[model samples]
Target: MNAPITACYPDPGTARPLTGLYLDHALPDRGRHGPFIYANYIASLDGRISVPADTGGQGVPESIANARDWRLFQELAGQADLLLSSGRYLRDLEAGTAQDSLPIGIDDAFSDIRAWRVRHGLAPQPDVAVLSAGLDFAVPRRLLDQGRRVIVITGESVPDSRVQAHERAGTEVIVLPNVARPGGAALVTALQALAYRRIYTVAGPFVLHTLLSANLLDSLFLTTVHRLIGGQPFASLCEGDLLAETGDFQLASMHLDAHGPGGCTQTFSRYDRTPGP
Candidate 1:
Protein backbone atom coordinates (compact mmCIF):
# COMPACT_ATOMS: atom_id res chain seq x y z
CA MET A 1 0.00 0.00 0.00
CA ASN A 2 1.29 3.43 -0.90
CA ALA A 3 1.24 6.13 1.79
CA PRO A 4 -1.19 9.05 1.49
CA ILE A 5 0.36 12.05 -0.22
CA THR A 6 -0.12 15.39 1.55
CA ALA A 7 -2.04 17.76 -0.74
CA CYS A 8 -4.17 20.90 -0.68
CA TYR A 9 -6.90 22.33 -2.96
CA PRO A 10 -8.02 25.90 -3.58
CA ASP A 11 -9.59 27.39 -0.48
CA PRO A 12 -12.75 28.61 -2.27
CA GLY A 13 -11.35 32.12 -1.96
CA THR A 14 -9.55 32.28 -5.29
CA ALA A 15 -10.94 35.17 -7.30
CA ARG A 16 -10.29 33.90 -10.86
CA PRO A 17 -12.07 30.63 -10.07
CA LEU A 18 -12.60 27.38 -11.99
CA THR A 19 -16.28 27.64 -13.07
CA GLY A 20 -15.78 28.60 -16.72
CA LEU A 21 -12.91 26.23 -17.22
CA TYR A 22 -15.00 23.42 -15.74
CA LEU A 23 -17.92 24.13 -18.03
CA ASP A 24 -15.69 24.10 -21.09
CA HIS A 25 -13.88 21.03 -19.87
CA ALA A 26 -17.08 19.04 -19.48
CA LEU A 27 -18.86 19.51 -22.82
CA PRO A 28 -16.94 17.82 -25.61
CA ASP A 29 -17.83 17.80 -29.28
CA ARG A 30 -20.65 15.37 -29.98
CA GLY A 31 -20.32 12.27 -32.13
CA ARG A 32 -22.73 9.89 -33.86
CA HIS A 33 -21.77 7.09 -31.49
CA GLY A 34 -23.41 9.28 -28.84
CA PRO A 35 -22.97 12.39 -26.69
CA PHE A 36 -19.68 12.42 -24.84
CA ILE A 37 -19.83 10.93 -21.36
CA TYR A 38 -17.20 11.54 -18.70
CA ALA A 39 -16.38 9.36 -15.76
CA ASN A 40 -15.36 11.36 -12.65
CA TYR A 41 -13.50 9.99 -9.65
CA ILE A 42 -10.92 10.64 -6.91
CA ALA A 43 -8.17 8.41 -5.63
CA SER A 44 -5.12 8.15 -3.42
CA LEU A 45 -1.67 8.13 -4.98
CA ASP A 46 -1.75 4.35 -4.84
CA GLY A 47 -5.10 4.26 -6.66
CA ARG A 48 -7.38 3.30 -3.77
CA ILE A 49 -11.03 4.42 -4.00
CA SER A 50 -11.97 4.15 -0.36
CA VAL A 51 -10.24 4.37 2.97
CA PRO A 52 -8.13 1.33 3.76
CA ALA A 53 -8.68 0.77 7.49
CA ASP A 54 -11.95 -1.10 6.91
CA THR A 55 -13.25 1.12 9.68
CA GLY A 56 -16.25 -0.76 8.44
CA GLY A 57 -16.12 1.45 5.33
CA GLN A 58 -13.76 3.10 2.87
CA GLY A 59 -10.91 5.22 4.18
CA VAL A 60 -11.64 8.56 5.72
CA PRO A 61 -9.91 11.85 4.95
CA GLU A 62 -9.39 15.10 6.80
CA SER A 63 -11.87 17.94 6.34
CA ILE A 64 -9.73 19.72 3.74
CA ALA A 65 -9.41 16.68 1.56
CA ASN A 66 -13.05 15.86 1.97
CA ALA A 67 -14.00 19.41 1.01
CA ARG A 68 -11.84 19.34 -2.10
CA ASP A 69 -13.34 16.03 -3.15
CA TRP A 70 -16.89 17.22 -2.65
CA ARG A 71 -16.04 20.36 -4.56
CA LEU A 72 -14.89 18.27 -7.50
CA PHE A 73 -17.88 16.02 -7.09
CA GLN A 74 -20.31 18.92 -7.09
CA GLU A 75 -18.73 20.39 -10.19
CA LEU A 76 -18.94 17.18 -12.18
CA ALA A 77 -22.28 16.33 -10.68
CA GLY A 78 -23.58 19.65 -11.93
CA GLN A 79 -22.33 19.00 -15.46
CA ALA A 80 -24.05 15.68 -15.91
CA ASP A 81 -27.67 15.60 -17.03
CA LEU A 82 -27.90 12.03 -15.89
CA LEU A 83 -26.10 10.43 -12.94
CA LEU A 84 -25.63 6.66 -13.15
CA SER A 85 -24.29 4.33 -10.49
CA SER A 86 -24.29 0.73 -9.43
CA GLY A 87 -26.56 -0.42 -6.64
CA ARG A 88 -23.49 -1.06 -4.54
CA TYR A 89 -22.39 2.59 -4.55
CA LEU A 90 -25.80 3.76 -3.45
CA ARG A 91 -25.77 1.24 -0.66
CA ASP A 92 -22.34 2.21 0.47
CA LEU A 93 -22.49 5.97 0.06
CA GLU A 94 -26.15 6.81 0.63
CA ALA A 95 -28.24 4.17 2.21
CA GLY A 96 -25.98 1.90 4.26
CA THR A 97 -29.22 0.08 4.91
CA ALA A 98 -31.03 -2.76 3.23
CA GLN A 99 -34.32 -0.93 2.93
CA ASP A 100 -34.96 0.78 -0.38
CA SER A 101 -35.62 4.36 0.72
CA LEU A 102 -32.96 6.99 1.37
CA PRO A 103 -33.03 9.29 4.38
CA ILE A 104 -35.40 12.26 4.37
CA GLY A 105 -32.82 14.94 3.54
CA ILE A 106 -31.33 12.98 0.63
CA ASP A 107 -33.70 14.40 -1.97
CA ASP A 108 -33.01 18.01 -0.97
CA ALA A 109 -29.26 17.48 -1.13
CA PHE A 110 -29.59 16.02 -4.60
CA SER A 111 -31.79 18.94 -5.51
CA ASP A 112 -28.79 21.18 -4.94
CA ILE A 113 -26.82 19.22 -7.52
CA ARG A 114 -29.84 19.55 -9.81
CA ALA A 115 -30.06 23.28 -9.25
CA TRP A 116 -26.50 23.71 -10.45
CA ARG A 117 -27.37 21.90 -13.65
CA VAL A 118 -30.41 24.12 -14.11
CA ARG A 119 -28.36 27.28 -13.58
CA HIS A 120 -26.26 26.13 -16.53
CA GLY A 121 -29.47 25.50 -18.52
CA LEU A 122 -29.01 21.79 -18.14
CA ALA A 123 -31.81 19.55 -16.87
CA PRO A 124 -33.54 20.76 -13.73
CA GLN A 125 -33.24 17.43 -12.04
CA PRO A 126 -31.16 14.79 -13.68
CA ASP A 127 -32.63 11.35 -14.13
CA VAL A 128 -31.00 9.42 -11.28
CA ALA A 129 -30.51 5.90 -12.57
CA VAL A 130 -29.56 2.83 -10.54
CA LEU A 131 -28.80 -0.68 -11.74
CA SER A 132 -29.34 -3.64 -9.48
CA ALA A 133 -29.97 -7.35 -9.47
CA GLY A 134 -33.18 -6.85 -7.50
CA LEU A 135 -35.56 -4.04 -6.63
CA ASP A 136 -34.91 -1.42 -3.99
CA PHE A 137 -38.07 0.60 -3.54
CA ALA A 138 -36.41 3.06 -1.16
CA VAL A 139 -34.36 4.68 -3.89
CA PRO A 140 -37.16 5.51 -6.36
CA ARG A 141 -39.43 6.83 -3.65
CA ARG A 142 -36.75 9.01 -2.10
CA LEU A 143 -35.40 10.39 -5.36
CA LEU A 144 -38.81 11.02 -6.85
CA ASP A 145 -39.78 13.07 -3.84
CA GLN A 146 -36.99 15.45 -4.73
CA GLY A 147 -38.55 15.93 -8.19
CA ARG A 148 -35.78 13.86 -9.77
CA ARG A 149 -36.75 10.99 -12.00
CA VAL A 150 -35.58 7.76 -10.43
CA ILE A 151 -34.90 4.83 -12.70
CA VAL A 152 -34.43 1.34 -11.35
CA ILE A 153 -32.84 -1.25 -13.66
CA THR A 154 -33.24 -4.79 -12.53
CA GLY A 155 -32.52 -8.19 -14.02
CA GLU A 156 -35.24 -9.98 -12.14
CA SER A 157 -38.85 -9.39 -12.99
CA VAL A 158 -40.23 -6.43 -11.06
CA PRO A 159 -43.24 -7.08 -8.97
CA ASP A 160 -46.32 -5.11 -9.97
CA SER A 161 -46.55 -3.54 -6.55
CA ARG A 162 -43.06 -2.07 -6.83
CA VAL A 163 -43.83 -0.82 -10.32
CA GLN A 164 -47.02 0.75 -9.10
CA ALA A 165 -45.18 2.29 -6.18
CA HIS A 166 -42.65 3.91 -8.49
CA GLU A 167 -45.31 5.21 -10.83
CA ARG A 168 -47.25 6.62 -7.93
CA ALA A 169 -44.18 8.44 -6.77
CA GLY A 170 -43.37 9.59 -10.33
CA THR A 171 -40.37 7.35 -10.94
CA GLU A 172 -39.53 4.96 -13.78
CA VAL A 173 -38.74 1.31 -13.27
CA ILE A 174 -37.08 -0.63 -16.08
CA VAL A 175 -36.81 -4.40 -16.13
CA LEU A 176 -34.21 -6.31 -18.13
CA PRO A 177 -33.70 -10.03 -18.41
CA ASN A 178 -29.91 -9.89 -18.45
CA VAL A 179 -28.34 -7.42 -16.02
CA ALA A 180 -25.79 -9.43 -14.16
CA ARG A 181 -22.67 -8.04 -15.89
CA PRO A 182 -21.80 -5.86 -18.85
CA GLY A 183 -25.20 -4.25 -18.49
CA GLY A 184 -23.88 -0.71 -18.73
CA ALA A 185 -24.04 -0.57 -22.53
CA ALA A 186 -27.63 -1.78 -22.31
CA LEU A 187 -28.29 0.77 -19.60
CA VAL A 188 -26.84 3.52 -21.74
CA THR A 189 -29.04 2.45 -24.63
CA ALA A 190 -32.05 2.43 -22.39
CA LEU A 191 -31.28 5.88 -20.98
CA GLN A 192 -30.65 7.22 -24.47
CA ALA A 193 -33.98 5.86 -25.55
CA LEU A 194 -35.45 7.75 -22.61
CA ALA A 195 -33.77 10.93 -23.93
CA TYR A 196 -30.96 11.14 -21.39
CA ARG A 197 -27.75 12.60 -22.78
CA ARG A 198 -24.62 13.59 -20.89
CA ILE A 199 -24.50 10.54 -18.72
CA TYR A 200 -22.10 10.24 -15.77
CA THR A 201 -21.18 6.88 -14.28
CA VAL A 202 -19.92 6.86 -10.64
CA ALA A 203 -19.43 3.81 -8.53
CA GLY A 204 -17.15 1.35 -6.77
CA PRO A 205 -14.49 -0.69 -8.56
CA PHE A 206 -16.76 -3.43 -9.86
CA VAL A 207 -19.07 -1.26 -11.94
CA LEU A 208 -16.14 0.92 -12.99
CA HIS A 209 -14.37 -2.24 -14.02
CA THR A 210 -17.36 -3.45 -15.99
CA LEU A 211 -17.73 -0.26 -18.02
CA LEU A 212 -14.01 0.06 -18.69
CA SER A 213 -13.68 -3.54 -19.78
CA ALA A 214 -16.64 -3.00 -22.09
CA ASN A 215 -14.90 -0.01 -23.73
CA LEU A 216 -17.85 2.19 -22.86
CA LEU A 217 -16.01 5.02 -21.12
CA ASP A 218 -15.49 8.28 -23.05
CA SER A 219 -13.70 10.45 -20.48
CA LEU A 220 -12.15 10.04 -17.07
CA PHE A 221 -11.68 12.84 -14.50
CA LEU A 222 -9.44 12.22 -11.56
CA THR A 223 -8.31 14.41 -8.66
CA THR A 224 -4.82 13.28 -7.94
CA VAL A 225 -4.00 14.45 -4.43
CA HIS A 226 -0.28 14.04 -3.97
CA ARG A 227 -0.79 11.23 -1.49
CA LEU A 228 -0.01 7.56 -1.44
CA ILE A 229 -2.48 4.93 -0.19
CA GLY A 230 -3.04 1.22 -0.59
CA GLY A 231 -5.42 -0.04 -3.29
CA GLN A 232 -5.52 -1.93 -6.59
CA PRO A 233 -5.51 -0.47 -10.09
CA PHE A 234 -8.93 -0.04 -11.62
CA ALA A 235 -9.56 -2.67 -14.30
CA SER A 236 -8.09 -1.77 -17.67
CA LEU A 237 -10.42 -0.35 -20.29
CA CYS A 238 -9.67 -3.13 -22.77
CA GLU A 239 -8.63 -6.75 -22.86
CA GLY A 240 -5.42 -6.17 -24.82
CA ASP A 241 -3.14 -3.53 -26.28
CA LEU A 242 -5.49 -1.14 -28.11
CA LEU A 243 -3.17 1.80 -28.75
CA ALA A 244 -1.22 0.16 -31.58
CA GLU A 245 -4.16 -0.79 -33.81
CA THR A 246 -5.26 1.27 -36.83
CA GLY A 247 -8.27 3.60 -36.37
CA ASP A 248 -8.00 2.43 -32.81
CA PHE A 249 -7.52 5.49 -30.61
CA GLN A 250 -7.31 9.24 -30.03
CA LEU A 251 -5.64 11.73 -27.68
CA ALA A 252 -7.00 12.67 -24.24
CA SER A 253 -6.15 16.16 -23.01
CA MET A 254 -5.75 16.68 -19.28
CA HIS A 255 -5.65 19.80 -17.07
CA LEU A 256 -3.83 19.73 -13.79
CA ASP A 257 -3.87 22.29 -11.03
CA ALA A 258 -0.74 24.42 -11.27
CA HIS A 259 -0.73 24.28 -7.46
CA GLY A 260 -2.47 22.24 -4.82
CA PRO A 261 -2.61 21.07 -1.22
CA GLY A 262 -0.77 18.44 -3.11
CA GLY A 263 -4.04 17.94 -5.06
CA CYS A 264 -4.51 18.11 -8.83
CA THR A 265 -7.56 17.64 -11.06
CA GLN A 266 -6.92 15.50 -14.11
CA THR A 267 -9.38 15.12 -16.99
CA PHE A 268 -8.90 12.37 -19.55
CA SER A 269 -8.76 13.06 -23.27
CA ARG A 270 -12.13 11.97 -24.61
CA TYR A 271 -12.49 9.44 -27.43
CA ASP A 272 -14.54 6.55 -28.73
CA ARG A 273 -13.41 2.96 -28.57
CA THR A 274 -11.83 1.77 -31.78
CA PRO A 275 -12.76 -1.60 -33.16
CA GLY A 276 -10.60 -4.51 -32.04
CA PRO A 277 -7.80 -5.57 -34.35
Candidate 2:
Protein backbone atom coordinates (compact mmCIF):
# COMPACT_ATOMS: atom_id res chain seq x y z
CA MET A 1 0.00 0.00 0.00
CA ASN A 2 1.18 3.53 -0.75
CA ALA A 3 1.61 5.60 2.37
CA PRO A 4 0.42 9.19 2.44
CA ILE A 5 3.04 11.73 3.33
CA THR A 6 2.08 12.87 6.84
CA ALA A 7 3.71 16.29 6.81
CA CYS A 8 6.17 18.37 4.80
CA TYR A 9 8.12 21.23 6.34
CA PRO A 10 8.56 24.79 5.07
CA ASP A 11 5.20 24.26 3.45
CA PRO A 12 5.25 25.10 -0.24
CA GLY A 13 4.01 28.65 0.28
CA THR A 14 1.42 29.98 -2.19
CA ALA A 15 4.11 31.43 -4.45
CA ARG A 16 5.33 28.16 -6.06
CA PRO A 17 2.71 25.64 -7.10
CA LEU A 18 3.05 22.00 -6.12
CA THR A 19 2.75 19.26 -8.75
CA GLY A 20 2.44 15.47 -8.96
CA LEU A 21 4.69 13.49 -6.62
CA TYR A 22 6.63 16.66 -6.03
CA LEU A 23 3.86 17.88 -3.76
CA ASP A 24 5.91 20.30 -1.73
CA HIS A 25 7.57 22.13 -4.62
CA ALA A 26 8.77 21.70 -8.17
CA LEU A 27 12.13 20.10 -8.76
CA PRO A 28 14.99 22.55 -9.04
CA ASP A 29 15.81 23.48 -12.63
CA ARG A 30 18.95 21.89 -14.05
CA GLY A 31 20.48 24.50 -16.30
CA ARG A 32 22.25 23.78 -19.61
CA HIS A 33 25.47 23.06 -17.74
CA GLY A 34 25.95 19.64 -16.20
CA PRO A 35 25.46 17.69 -12.98
CA PHE A 36 23.90 18.65 -9.67
CA ILE A 37 24.50 15.65 -7.45
CA TYR A 38 22.23 14.54 -4.60
CA ALA A 39 22.10 11.36 -2.59
CA ASN A 40 19.38 9.42 -0.75
CA TYR A 41 19.97 6.95 2.06
CA ILE A 42 18.21 5.25 4.96
CA ALA A 43 19.85 4.54 8.27
CA SER A 44 18.92 3.24 11.70
CA LEU A 45 18.52 5.48 14.75
CA ASP A 46 21.86 4.18 15.99
CA GLY A 47 23.48 5.13 12.66
CA ARG A 48 24.18 1.70 11.24
CA ILE A 49 23.73 1.37 7.49
CA SER A 50 23.92 -2.41 7.31
CA VAL A 51 23.00 -5.50 9.24
CA PRO A 52 25.57 -6.62 11.78
CA ALA A 53 28.74 -7.87 10.15
CA ASP A 54 27.06 -8.67 6.83
CA THR A 55 29.80 -8.68 4.22
CA GLY A 56 27.69 -7.36 1.34
CA GLY A 57 26.66 -4.36 3.51
CA GLN A 58 23.93 -2.92 1.31
CA GLY A 59 21.90 -0.95 3.87
CA VAL A 60 18.52 -0.39 2.19
CA PRO A 61 17.06 -3.67 3.36
CA GLU A 62 18.12 -3.22 6.93
CA SER A 63 16.71 0.31 7.23
CA ILE A 64 14.01 0.98 4.67
CA ALA A 65 11.13 -1.38 5.42
CA ASN A 66 8.59 1.33 6.11
CA ALA A 67 6.11 2.31 3.41
CA ARG A 68 6.81 6.02 3.84
CA ASP A 69 10.51 5.62 3.23
CA TRP A 70 9.88 3.40 0.22
CA ARG A 71 7.54 5.97 -1.29
CA LEU A 72 10.04 8.78 -0.76
CA PHE A 73 12.72 6.65 -2.41
CA GLN A 74 10.54 6.28 -5.49
CA GLU A 75 9.79 9.99 -5.54
CA LEU A 76 13.49 10.90 -5.49
CA ALA A 77 14.27 8.41 -8.26
CA GLY A 78 11.58 9.92 -10.47
CA GLN A 79 13.14 13.39 -10.20
CA ALA A 80 16.64 12.50 -11.35
CA ASP A 81 18.06 12.62 -14.89
CA LEU A 82 20.72 10.11 -13.93
CA LEU A 83 21.09 7.58 -11.13
CA LEU A 84 24.62 6.88 -9.90
CA SER A 85 25.54 3.68 -8.12
CA SER A 86 28.52 1.53 -7.33
CA GLY A 87 29.07 -1.78 -9.12
CA ARG A 88 28.51 -3.74 -5.90
CA TYR A 89 25.33 -1.78 -5.20
CA LEU A 90 24.02 -2.61 -8.67
CA ARG A 91 24.87 -6.26 -8.19
CA ASP A 92 22.99 -6.32 -4.90
CA LEU A 93 19.91 -4.90 -6.60
CA GLU A 94 20.17 -7.50 -9.36
CA ALA A 95 20.38 -10.31 -6.81
CA GLY A 96 17.14 -9.07 -5.19
CA THR A 97 18.90 -9.00 -1.85
CA ALA A 98 19.00 -5.26 -1.62
CA GLN A 99 15.44 -5.54 -0.30
CA ASP A 100 14.51 -2.38 -2.15
CA SER A 101 12.61 -1.60 -5.29
CA LEU A 102 14.49 -1.02 -8.55
CA PRO A 103 14.79 2.40 -10.13
CA ILE A 104 12.48 1.29 -12.93
CA GLY A 105 9.80 0.65 -10.35
CA ILE A 106 9.47 4.42 -10.03
CA ASP A 107 8.14 4.53 -13.60
CA ASP A 108 5.10 2.51 -12.59
CA ALA A 109 4.36 4.19 -9.27
CA PHE A 110 4.65 7.73 -10.60
CA SER A 111 3.94 7.82 -14.31
CA ASP A 112 3.26 11.54 -14.01
CA ILE A 113 6.92 12.17 -13.21
CA ARG A 114 7.97 10.26 -16.32
CA ALA A 115 5.51 12.22 -18.39
CA TRP A 116 6.91 15.45 -16.99
CA ARG A 117 10.42 14.38 -17.99
CA VAL A 118 9.34 13.62 -21.54
CA ARG A 119 7.54 16.94 -21.81
CA HIS A 120 10.72 18.69 -20.79
CA GLY A 121 12.64 16.85 -23.57
CA LEU A 122 14.26 14.37 -21.20
CA ALA A 123 14.53 10.62 -21.58
CA PRO A 124 11.57 8.50 -20.47
CA GLN A 125 13.86 6.93 -17.90
CA PRO A 126 16.95 8.17 -16.12
CA ASP A 127 20.33 6.82 -17.17
CA VAL A 128 22.11 4.49 -14.73
CA ALA A 129 25.81 5.13 -14.21
CA VAL A 130 27.79 2.53 -12.32
CA LEU A 131 31.25 3.12 -10.85
CA SER A 132 33.81 0.44 -10.35
CA ALA A 133 37.58 0.68 -10.00
CA GLY A 134 38.40 -2.89 -10.98
CA LEU A 135 35.37 -3.25 -13.31
CA ASP A 136 35.10 -6.81 -12.03
CA PHE A 137 31.40 -7.17 -11.28
CA ALA A 138 28.14 -8.32 -12.83
CA VAL A 139 24.98 -6.25 -12.97
CA PRO A 140 21.50 -7.31 -13.97
CA ARG A 141 21.49 -8.24 -17.64
CA ARG A 142 18.21 -6.39 -18.03
CA LEU A 143 19.91 -3.09 -17.13
CA LEU A 144 22.23 -3.45 -20.12
CA ASP A 145 20.10 -5.41 -22.57
CA GLN A 146 17.00 -3.34 -22.00
CA GLY A 147 17.26 -0.15 -24.19
CA ARG A 148 18.28 1.93 -21.20
CA ARG A 149 21.59 3.76 -21.30
CA VAL A 150 24.05 2.25 -18.81
CA ILE A 151 27.49 3.76 -18.47
CA VAL A 152 30.37 2.15 -16.60
CA ILE A 153 33.04 4.43 -15.11
CA THR A 154 36.18 2.65 -14.10
CA GLY A 155 39.88 3.24 -13.50
CA GLU A 156 42.57 2.32 -16.00
CA SER A 157 43.51 -0.51 -13.66
CA VAL A 158 40.62 -2.47 -15.14
CA PRO A 159 41.75 -4.86 -17.85
CA ASP A 160 40.74 -4.32 -21.48
CA SER A 161 38.97 -7.67 -21.46
CA ARG A 162 36.61 -6.53 -18.71
CA VAL A 163 35.94 -3.27 -20.52
CA GLN A 164 35.16 -5.19 -23.72
CA ALA A 165 32.82 -7.49 -21.78
CA HIS A 166 30.89 -4.49 -20.49
CA GLU A 167 30.73 -3.06 -24.02
CA ARG A 168 29.54 -6.40 -25.36
CA ALA A 169 26.77 -6.28 -22.78
CA GLY A 170 25.67 -2.92 -24.26
CA THR A 171 27.22 -0.55 -21.73
CA GLU A 172 29.44 2.44 -22.53
CA VAL A 173 32.70 2.45 -20.63
CA ILE A 174 34.79 5.47 -19.58
CA VAL A 175 38.25 4.74 -18.24
CA LEU A 176 39.54 7.40 -15.85
CA PRO A 177 43.00 7.51 -14.32
CA ASN A 178 43.25 5.58 -11.06
CA VAL A 179 43.32 7.91 -8.05
CA ALA A 180 43.38 7.53 -4.29
CA ARG A 181 39.87 8.92 -4.35
CA PRO A 182 37.59 8.30 -7.34
CA GLY A 183 34.84 10.93 -7.05
CA GLY A 184 36.84 13.96 -8.14
CA ALA A 185 36.96 16.38 -11.06
CA ALA A 186 37.33 13.65 -13.69
CA LEU A 187 34.07 11.95 -12.77
CA VAL A 188 32.23 15.26 -12.78
CA THR A 189 33.68 16.16 -16.16
CA ALA A 190 32.60 12.84 -17.62
CA LEU A 191 29.01 13.33 -16.45
CA GLN A 192 29.06 16.88 -17.78
CA ALA A 193 30.13 15.60 -21.18
CA LEU A 194 27.04 13.39 -21.24
CA ALA A 195 24.80 16.39 -20.45
CA TYR A 196 23.40 14.84 -17.31
CA ARG A 197 22.38 17.71 -15.09
CA ARG A 198 20.36 16.23 -12.27
CA ILE A 199 22.04 13.18 -10.78
CA TYR A 200 20.79 11.12 -7.83
CA THR A 201 22.95 8.52 -6.19
CA VAL A 202 21.64 5.61 -4.14
CA ALA A 203 24.68 3.88 -2.71
CA GLY A 204 26.28 2.35 0.34
CA PRO A 205 28.64 3.97 2.83
CA PHE A 206 31.97 3.76 1.05
CA VAL A 207 30.63 5.48 -2.05
CA LEU A 208 28.95 8.18 0.03
CA HIS A 209 32.16 8.81 1.92
CA THR A 210 34.09 9.40 -1.28
CA LEU A 211 31.56 11.84 -2.68
CA LEU A 212 31.10 13.66 0.63
CA SER A 213 34.82 14.02 1.13
CA ALA A 214 35.26 15.44 -2.34
CA ASN A 215 32.55 18.07 -1.58
CA LEU A 216 30.71 16.93 -4.70
CA LEU A 217 27.39 16.17 -3.04
CA ASP A 218 24.95 19.06 -3.11
CA SER A 219 22.11 17.63 -1.05
CA LEU A 220 21.44 14.65 1.13
CA PHE A 221 18.10 12.95 1.76
CA LEU A 222 18.16 10.73 4.80
CA THR A 223 15.47 8.61 6.47
CA THR A 224 15.95 7.61 10.04
CA VAL A 225 14.18 4.39 11.05
CA HIS A 226 12.85 3.84 14.56
CA ARG A 227 14.32 0.41 15.07
CA LEU A 228 17.82 -0.31 16.27
CA ILE A 229 20.06 -3.26 15.41
CA GLY A 230 23.13 -3.32 17.60
CA GLY A 231 26.13 -5.47 16.78
CA GLN A 232 29.85 -5.33 16.20
CA PRO A 233 31.43 -4.05 12.99
CA PHE A 234 28.18 -2.75 11.55
CA ALA A 235 28.62 -0.21 8.79
CA SER A 236 27.43 3.36 9.36
CA LEU A 237 25.90 5.70 6.81
CA CYS A 238 29.40 7.03 5.94
CA GLU A 239 32.00 4.30 6.14
CA GLY A 240 35.54 5.34 5.24
CA ASP A 241 38.47 6.98 6.86
CA LEU A 242 37.35 9.86 9.06
CA LEU A 243 37.36 13.24 7.35
CA ALA A 244 40.17 15.60 8.35
CA GLU A 245 37.50 18.09 9.36
CA THR A 246 33.77 17.80 9.76
CA GLY A 247 31.39 18.51 6.90
CA ASP A 248 28.44 20.72 7.77
CA PHE A 249 24.91 20.56 6.44
CA GLN A 250 21.92 22.79 7.05
CA LEU A 251 18.51 21.15 7.23
CA ALA A 252 16.46 22.29 4.27
CA SER A 253 13.26 20.41 4.99
CA MET A 254 11.94 17.66 7.21
CA HIS A 255 8.92 15.34 7.27
CA LEU A 256 7.62 12.97 9.89
CA ASP A 257 5.37 9.94 9.51
CA ALA A 258 4.59 8.29 12.80
CA HIS A 259 1.59 6.18 11.89
CA GLY A 260 3.48 3.25 10.41
CA PRO A 261 2.10 -0.28 10.53
CA GLY A 262 4.50 -1.51 13.22
CA GLY A 263 4.56 1.47 15.54
CA CYS A 264 7.55 2.83 13.68
CA THR A 265 8.21 6.52 13.27
CA GLN A 266 10.16 7.49 10.17
CA THR A 267 11.71 10.89 9.72
CA PHE A 268 12.84 12.10 6.32
CA SER A 269 15.11 15.10 6.17
CA ARG A 270 16.82 16.99 3.38
CA TYR A 271 20.09 18.72 4.15
CA ASP A 272 22.05 21.09 1.94
CA ARG A 273 25.76 21.64 2.32
CA THR A 274 26.52 24.55 4.66
CA PRO A 275 28.81 27.03 2.98
CA GLY A 276 32.32 27.44 4.33
CA PRO A 277 33.26 30.59 6.13
The predictions' CA RMSDs to the true structure, in order, are: 7.5, 3.8
Task: Give the clash total for candidate 2.
Answer: 0
Per-prediction TM-score: 0.66, 0.83
Highest lDDT model number: 2
Query: Worst lDDT window (10 residues) for model 2?
Result: 12-21
Q: lDDT for every model? A: 0.51, 0.68
Misplaced by over 4 Å in model 2 are 1-24, 31-33, 52-64, 93-96, 106-108, 178-181
Tens digit per residue, CA lDDT, model 2, 1-277: 3344444666732222112234235456453234677888777778766663254544544444565566667677777878888877766676666654345355465676566566667676778888888777766776655567888888767789989988887789888765533566676667678887778887778788877776667778888877776755777878888885566789887666664436777667888778662
Cα RMSD for predicted model 2: 3.8
Give the per-residue Cα lDDT of candidate 2 at 115: 65
Checking candidate 2 for backbone clashes, the offending pairs are none
Error of 2 at 113 (Å): 3.4
